[model samples]
Each structure stands twice: as C-alpha cells, then as structure tokens.
Target: MHSDRHEPAPLRVELAGARLAGPAPVPTGVTASRPAAAVPHPTPTQPLSPARLDTPSTWPRRTLLRLVGASAVGLPVVAALAACAEDDTVHPPDPLAAQEVLARADAAAATAAIALAPGSHAALSTIATERTAHADALRTEIDRVIGVYGDGTTPVHRTGALTVPGPGGSPVPASEVETASAQPSTLDGVRDQLVRSQQSAAALARTESGYRAGLLASISAACATQAGVLLT
Candidate 1:
C-alpha cells in the first residue's frame, strides 16, 4: 500500500553573509525576540572659553546697536560737561573803578578852572596840583591791585576810562578836558564839580575800610576845602 502522508517541504533561511537550506523544525513554547532597545547617544559638550562665554555675541542686532549708539552720544556730553566745569571761573569788577573816574574828572576840572580865571591863578594852581596828585595816586593803586603776569607784563584791564558830564551837559572821556571851542565853563561850574566829587568820595568812604577808606576820606576833605574855601 502507498503512504498516505507526504513529508514537509524543505525550509530555506537567509542570514547576514550566509545562506542555508535544511528541514529546520519550528520551535514551540519560545517567545518572539524584539530588536534590542535602541540606545540614545549623549550630545557632545563644548569647552567653556571666553569666546563661547561672551554674551554680546548672543545679543540681538537691534539691542547691540542701541547700546553702541548710547555710548557714542554719552561721550560728547561728558566732554562738554568737563569743559563747562573748567570754564566756570568768575572775575569780579574792580571796587575802585568809579573812584578812579571821579578823581580823573576832578583833575581835569581844576586845570580848566585855572585857564578860565587868571585872577585866581594861585588858588587854582594849588587845586590843580592837588587834584592831579589825587588822580595819580588813585591810578597807581588801581595798577598795583591789577597785578602783573609771570612775564612781568601787565594784564589787559577789563575796566576802561569812564566818561563824565562835561560843562555843556554832554559826556566826555575823563582823561580829556572839553576844548575851548565847546561851551566855556565859569569858576562856579568848577566849584559845582568839586562839590559833586566831594559828595561822591564821602559816600564811598563810608562803604570802604582800612587804607582805602582813609584815602577816600582825605580826598573828600580836600575837595570840600577847595569847593568851600579855595573856590570861594
């Protein structure tokens, strides 16, 4: 009798770099194998360095531009403030400025008086001499107070020669007397000028102290004597 059952077909297997043909039996009671759990690789770390640590590199372009612009603007402002601080020095006006002007005017008036009244030459000459002396003394004091530079050169004065009212009620430089072509002033006009000068000196003396006050007081007394006694 012929066999009723047929043998199983041959099994073919494929593997890496190899091939096999055989009647391999399928194993029972074995669990299917899963591919080994894929392992994750750690990311590489960069070394810490100044180039890597610099935060400005990470700043936004707009933010970096703003900071640079601020620094540029602030530098000029700081320089300007420094310059202003250096230029803040102040020079006060000289105290004897008005007195010097008055003395010079008195001298001119006394000299003019002599020319106007030849009969009173003796008294007028004395007055002119004394008045000129007062002007010279005042000028000397002013120059001494002004002081010289390191090179023995006198500094440029801020105060210039002031003007006084002339006999014609117009202003003229204190250094110059009105010309004869102008309105001729009488002895009474000279006396009036002396009186004003005396009053000015007396008023200023009260405000001053020390040597300056004494000088002004002496000037005031001399002017009073010339106006009240000499001119009379």
Candidate 2:
C-alpha cells in the first residue's frame, strides 16, 4: 500500500483592522436571500369588552321593553277617558214628585168619567162617590210622598186610554139599547158597570192602604159586597 499523506488542517486566518465588505458575496450554489424588511408589528387590538359587544344588539330590545311598559300604563288611562266621555252624555237629574201628582190626577179623571155616564144607576153613583174619595185621598198621599222626596217634574206622560165598563168589559149592543126601554137596560148596564167599579175600587184600596188601614179594609169589604150584589 502506498503511503497516504494527510493535508494539514487549514490554519485559522485573522485579519486585524479589516472592514467587512459591502454586500456579502453569495456562496457558490447557495442563494442569497435578503431578510425582508421587518414588517411593522401592529399594536395588539384591545379585546372587545362584553358590555360594548352586547350593547348595540340590546338597544333595540331595551327600546321595545320601554315601549311595552308605556303602552301598558297608558291603555287603562285611555279606557278611563272613554268612560268619562260616555257618562257626560247619558245621565241627567229627574223629578219624583210630579209623577205622584200626575198619578193622582189620572185616578181623579178616571173616577169622574165613571160617575158621569148617562146610564149610571144609584149603585154606580155610589161607587163613583167612593172613587172620588179615593182620588182625594190619593192626592193627599201623593202630596205627602212628594214633599218628602222632591218637587221636580219629570218629562214622562201617561199614554193609555180609559173607558167606562159595559157587559163583561165589552161594548153594549146598539140594537138592544135602541129597541128596548132605557130604564131597565140602563139599570142593567149600570149594574154591570157598578161591579167593575167596585172591583176596581177594592183594588185601589189595597194599593193605597196596603191592607194596613182599618178604614181601607172596611171600604174594600163594602165594595166587594156591592160588587156581589150587582153581579147577582
């Protein structure tokens, strides 16, 4: 084997006071890559606080809640205003005394009509006289009730018609009245009218006295007896 000679290791070179050249030369087969200019590091963005992140979305909900609250408060106030508007138009003060007076007058007029019929007999006349007393008593009572309550007059009026009684509350037959002597027929007609009058008078007595007064009960009994007589 031939003797191999080893090359001595390259000695360290030291260049005293030597300046580094302009651009370092690239080594063969190695690319020279310049370090990109340092990219400016942007200041780290502050983390979005929860309050700020949620505030924008919650604003509309908050506005809606306020609107709902205001509507709830205002709805009843609006209803109260409407009720006040209706009350202003519907109510008015009225009189109670005048009604009593008118009722008394009506009873008086009805009694007079019964007493003044042409064919009225003694029995009928007696009932008319009692009805006249009833009218008078009613007038006094009305005055008393009215004096206790009020003196104002109401706008209401009576609308029904009144008539004297005939047979079974019907009109007398014209042929019978014209052909027959009026004396007997008049007595018969008045008898029937007397029955109706007594019945009506007894009813009035009950209404006026409420069956509490001895005088009214006595009058009612007498009227009922007379009604039975006239019917028989």
Candidate 3:
C-alpha cells in the first residue's frame, strides 16, 4: 500500500499546568512615545517704555499763564493804597474887601460888650480901631477892583455860618463857627476862641489884597499876642 505516511501529530506540546510559563512576549510592530514635545515652557514678555514730559514747545504757554496770574493778584493792591491818601476839605474865598470889612467892624464893636479883665479893655479898643481902619481900606480896595463901593448885600461875610449853593442845584447849610467867646464860663475858653478866630482871620487875609493882607496879618498877630495874656 502506497499509503499515507502520517507524521506522528507533531509531537503534541503541553504547557506547565494550564498557564503559559516564562516571560510575557512583547508585540512586534508597535512603539511608545513622549507627550507632544512637552509644549516647551513659554518665556515671559518685556514691557514698553514711558512717554517724555519736558518739551521746548510747551514752555511759552506755561510762562504766559504765570504772568496773567501775577497781574490779577497785584493790580488791586496798588489801587487800594492810592484811594486812602486823598484829602477833601474845602474853605471859602475872600468877599469884596469892602462890605465884609463893615461886618468885621460890627463883630469888633460887639467885642466891647464882652467882659474882660483889667487892661484887656484898652487892648480891645485898639483892636476895634484897627478893625475900623481895615474896613475903610477894604472899601477903597473894592472900589479899585470892581469899580463900585460894596453894598452890604455883597458876600463880605460868607463865613462857615453862611448858607449857599452846592452841587446839583442844592444848598448846603453852612458849618457854624465854633467859638468859646459868646458866653464862655471860663477865661481859658475865651482865649481859645480868640486864637481860633485870629487863625481864621489870617486865612481870610491870605485871600485879599496887599493892604487887606497887611491889616489881617496885623490883627492876627495882635490877637495871638493877646491870647497869651488871657491864658496866663
């Protein structure tokens, strides 16, 4: 028989017990790799620089602002000082030397009735005589200047006690002459009045002619000299 020669069942191999023995075998065509290059740690970025502050173009505008501010502070201070130093008192002018001299003569005549100490009466008479002479001289001066004798109506006695015209067609009441002479209780008061009256007379003389000036000046001097006699 040309028969089949059968290999004996390829020597039937058996594993120890029912488990495969020896080391576990690795797979042939597979590999293990690292995570996507580990995403290399990103480096920190740098910050930008700041802008410049001081520039030549802005300097002129700053200077102008400073000058305007200084003027606003200084001008009013100068104006205030100027306002504080002004004087405003006003005095009257000399009347026609003539008519006023008579008024003065009347005032002088009244002086005799005023009570005074011994020897002062003679001095008072002298003053009255001088005032009468002054009246005559002023009459002559008035005739020379305005070509007429000054009637009593003229402004020869416009003392502070006289009421007259003022601004805006208004009439201001005149200030009264403050005198201690009318009825003084004390001698010192009379002397004070005499001094003030003489000073006022001197001021009036300054407003008159050369002759009136001399007369007023003499009267003023005589009154001043007499004041000390009463004061003592």
Better of 2 and 3 by TM-score: 3
Error of 1 at 53 (Å): 49
Q: Estimated TM-score per prediction?
A: 0.51, 0.28, 0.34
Q: How close is candidate 3 to the true structure, as a TM-score?
A: 0.34
TM-score of the candidate numbered 1?
0.51
Candidate 2 lDDT over residue span 102-182, tens digit each: 223323333444545544445555654554565455445544543431335432322222332234655343233223312
- Residue 3, candidate 2: C-alpha displacement in angstroms: 99
What local distance difference test score does each model get? 0.70, 0.45, 0.49
Q: By lDDT, rank the candidates, best first.
A: 1, 3, 2
Put down candidate 1 lDDT per residue, 1-232, tens digits, no spaces. 2443432223222332134554334479875566598898987887877776656766577587998999899998787557545654455545565566666666666666667788888887787789778877777777788786556767655554555544454657655543431333578877887787788778878998988889889999999999899989
Model 3 regions lying over 4 Å from their true place: 1-119, 149-190, 204-209, 229-232
Best by TM-score: 1
